[model samples]
Target: MSAFDDNPFAESAGVNPFNDPAVTQVTNSTVESVDQYNPFPATNLASQTTPASSSPYQPAVLQPSSEPTPQATATAAQANLLRQQEELERKAAELDRREQELQGRSSTGKENNWPPLPKSFPIKPCFYQDFSEEIPTEYQRVCKMMYYLWMFNCVTLFLNMLACLAYFTTSSTYGVDFGLSILWLILFAPCSFLCWYRPVYKAFKTDSSFSFFFFFFVFFCQVVIFIIQAVGIPRWGNSGWIAAFSVIKLSKAVCAIMFIVAILFTICAVMSIILLKMVHGMYRRTGASFHKAQQEFSQGIFTNKTFQSAAAGAASSAAQGAFQANN
Candidate 1:
């Protein structure tokens, strides 16, 4: 064998594949292309060489200077609790301030000449409800419900008038019923409002014994009126179920109207009964009594502006008469 053919690898080509010029050229080109695409040219490995210990990517383990003692932990908890306590105190103070504002408004209603209407408005707001908002939280809902009952009563009374007027086309006796209903509406509308509703409102507002007693007494009468109206006795202004069904054959339309009116009256009666029970339960808890009411009445009378003026005049006159008698 010849000297070149003595080695097996030298048979085809006497060159190493890894050390070939083409392979070295391709590797050098790939590295240059990667360097061209790098965004941070100044931070390239060729420009800056850093030791592994001083590298930018370092995994640091933070160690606290000292362990927390029990005293330190307790102090931290106490500080947090104190912050929470201060927050609660701030909230309670805000609530108290709001309560004081409400009570101040209640006491100064007469002083403020209440309803505080806007002077800019051309027309006055209806039915100046000065004391309505002063009702206690417990009774506010029930009081409004009672007012709705009154409205219902008024509507039913009006419908009863129409029904009775219609029934009059068949007979003359129903005319009396219609007239009485008109009178009943006229009297009860204002009287009931002044008697029970206003008193209950004021009772809750001022916690006045007189107002409580007055409400209980007048509302008792109101409850009786409701019962009587619901009964629909003959000659009564109310067109109750009995009276409506009794006159059904005469006029179906009138009967239907009367039936609706009767149902409303019945509902009013049932509601009145329920409300009376609830109100009485509340009143008993208020510690109101007849004696307390009398005292409040006397105090209220003595505090009246007219009564005070008359009392001053009487005292002045008595002093003058005594001076003349001494002279």
Candidate 2:
């Protein structure tokens, strides 16, 4: 009727395209699947509405470090000092051990051939050994003082030679003193170095009683020499008080020079005495004794090839002589 009112298909289907029963069933199934996987659930709405500061999301506050107190700083310094002291003691012990090993090697008659020298070389290179390095820390200062004294003595001796020369030029009578001064310088200089200085060095190095006693005996003689030199006896090589006054009548300039040398000699003597006392105290602490010295001397004597050879020769001669006499 209105366009033949409706076809038969149009009458069966709805006017809207979406009104198809198949499409409606598909839409309902898709919505049900989406609802099963909803990301923002409604139960968490209350937590999301709360302020961040009032919630568990607040940042942690940082605390500033406090300054150390005076007492704490002092304690730290003391601890550092103690650690340093311990390190020094450890180093000292290590050095002592090295010294002992070196001594042991020396006593065994073994030679160190490091950096081997050419056979054609005239002098053997023994420069690697330094006995001074082996001196103990407690005695190092005194040892250095002793070395300084030796140097002073050498200087004084040299100056005395000059003073004596000056006096000889002024007065022919003083020529003997000048000649003797030369001889004294020659003899005492090397002798003192070999006898007292080396022995003291070895004593401190090895705590050897023989070296200690040897040094003491030799240095005692040295002290006596200093006194005699200071006294400036006539015909003596030293330019002492007597020489200075005796030459004053000849030349005031020469007298002044001699007096100055004498003063230096006297100072050296006084210093030597003081240093000797100090060294003696240190020696006592080392427990060096005459008994130990005797033992060392005996050992040294037995080890000496010259002595052994001489003894063997003497014994053989005596045996031969006795056999001949018996025959």
Compared with the true structure, all predictions reach lDDT values of: 0.77, 0.83
Clash pairs for candidate 1: none
Shift in Å, residue 313, candidate 1: 3.7
lDDT value, candidate 2, whole model: 0.83
List TM-score per model, in order. Answer: 0.58, 0.60
- After the best TM-score superposition of candidate 1, give how far the Cα of residue 73 lies from its true spot, in angstroms: 65
TM-score of 2: 0.60
* lDDT of candidate 2 over 1-327, digit per residue (tens): 586766656534447778888988898774547448878666968766867767767688897869898999999999999999999779767755665556454644555542258868775544233424568888788877887888789889899999999999997888999999988888888788779987888788788999999999999999999999998998988899998998888899999999999999899889989989999998898888899999999977875558879999999999999999999
RMSD each, Å: 24.4, 20.6
Ten contiguous residues minimizing lDDT sum, candidate 2: 124-133
Which stretches in model 2 have alpha-carbon errors above 4 Å?
A: 1-132, 318-327
